[model samples]
Target: MEAVFSKEIQSGLDQARVASMKKSSRLRVCADGKKQTVLRMWKTGFAMEADAPDMRGMVDLYDGSIHLFRCLVVTTAEESGERHYEFKRATAVRGTPALDFETPEHAPAGLIEDAR
Candidate 1:
């Protein structure tokens, strides 16, 4: 789907250091099942590699305008241990069209390479 609003965050030093960077976007998706008022959040990240930067992205879905409230959190896993979480600006948007599976043209350059 096309992003109504998008933002990205980069951390660390060089590409290696910036490997843990994140990118987030706000988009509208179809609603299924009963409850119309629903909110969903999900995260995606890369695998760690020797001397490679690890990156991740978080996606949140709700009903309303875009770019509303955003925050980060730290949590511990009972089995895996502690983990760091980061998010983009608070964003909410309404309306839905057929899911656009096409890659966004406005995506940052070298995003794929940097994730490697």
Candidate 2:
């Protein structure tokens, strides 16, 4: 499948990685505080390494719900040898597409505003 990331997002992902050393594990993935985040990325593969502090701890959608897990960040060379991350303390998550935008709807006459 095609990789799904914009140039800006890609750049941010790259910047998140720490410089790889001969025997250093610089990648860190952390669990999110919100339950919904854990529900969003399960099952979807992590072909490329994600940004730590940002993409870390995101719940992957496994069988059905948001489950927590961890991934090791490695260099491209290291990934080429073995690309799959081993998840631990995981919870199942259901994937959901991110919102593109949010805007106020044009109100019609007699429409009650929700903010009251």
Candidate 3:
């Protein structure tokens, strides 16, 4: 279903959208940035809000202060009117790894030799 709005109302709504985009657009798709808000993402690709940059190639997916991934991407298709890209090479940037060493994996036999 579609609803029509008066020109004044539509203009106001457009202004609001611009404001919302500035304040709430937390996702970016450049090298640690995207041109605009990312509407959807996946393991191998992502979709940005309508009329996204006419761009392709390497980009980084970031949400707020967190880095998501570094990927080589190309425009693929559109989903629900949003532009989509496929990741040719997507490497996860999930922060550093942690090793919770409760104990050593292999103990020397000499340690047990003196014991029962």
Candidate 4:
């Protein structure tokens, strides 16, 4: 027999599940140009839906829309039945725009590397 829960009971359970979860993050995964929602995440690893792309090895992590990291990862089917990925290496990426202003010719020379 199928059991049903009242709206209030269901809502309570939903709220409980959310409350029991780790701190929510805007983190997401992008691989082979396909983006997938991050189901769960941790310092060393993260999980995406099991139906996510079979592509693995290298993945780019994003916070909502901003690029955050490049990770070398390996996949495993966790006991929880989720497609889990463990990070073998994670490197932070930063966007640095070229300096818009150029030093005046009168400015004292800094270094040969700076001229390059």
Identify the candidate with maximal TM-score: 4
Residue 73, model 4: lDDT of 86
Give the candidate order by descending lDDT: 4, 3, 2, 1
Q: What is the per-residue lDDT of model 2 for residues 1-116, given as tens digits with 9 covering 90 to 100?
A: 89989878876555444223212432223335432112112243333233222333334332233233334322232232123333444443335655688645974547676996
**Candidate 4 lDDT, tens digit per residue, 23-84?**
46577888887777776788989876555655568889998889999999888665333478
Q: Judged by lDDT against the true structure, how good is candidate 4? A: 0.74
Taken over the whole model, the C-alpha lDDT of each candidate is 0.31, 0.36, 0.70, 0.74
> On residues 9-64, what C-alpha lDDT tens digit does candidate 1 reach at each position?
22223333323331222222222321112112356211112332222333343335
Query: Could you tell me which 10 consecutive residues in candidate 2 have the lowest summed lDDT?
Result: 33-42
- The CA lDDT at 51 in model 2 is 28
Q: CA lDDT of 32 in candidate 1?
A: 34
Please provide TM-scores, in order, for all candidate models, with all chains considered together. Answer: 0.17, 0.19, 0.55, 0.58
lDDT of 4 at 39: 68
Show model 4 residue runs off by greater than 4 Å.
Answer: 1-25, 97-116
Give a tens-digit lDDT track for model 3, residues 18-106: 55654666777764343556765677787665567755777877787688887788888754456788889988896667657654578
- Candidate 2, residue 112: lDDT: 72
The per-prediction tally of clashing pairs is 5, 15, 6, 0
TM-score of decoy 1: 0.17
2 against 4, candidate with superior lDDT: 4
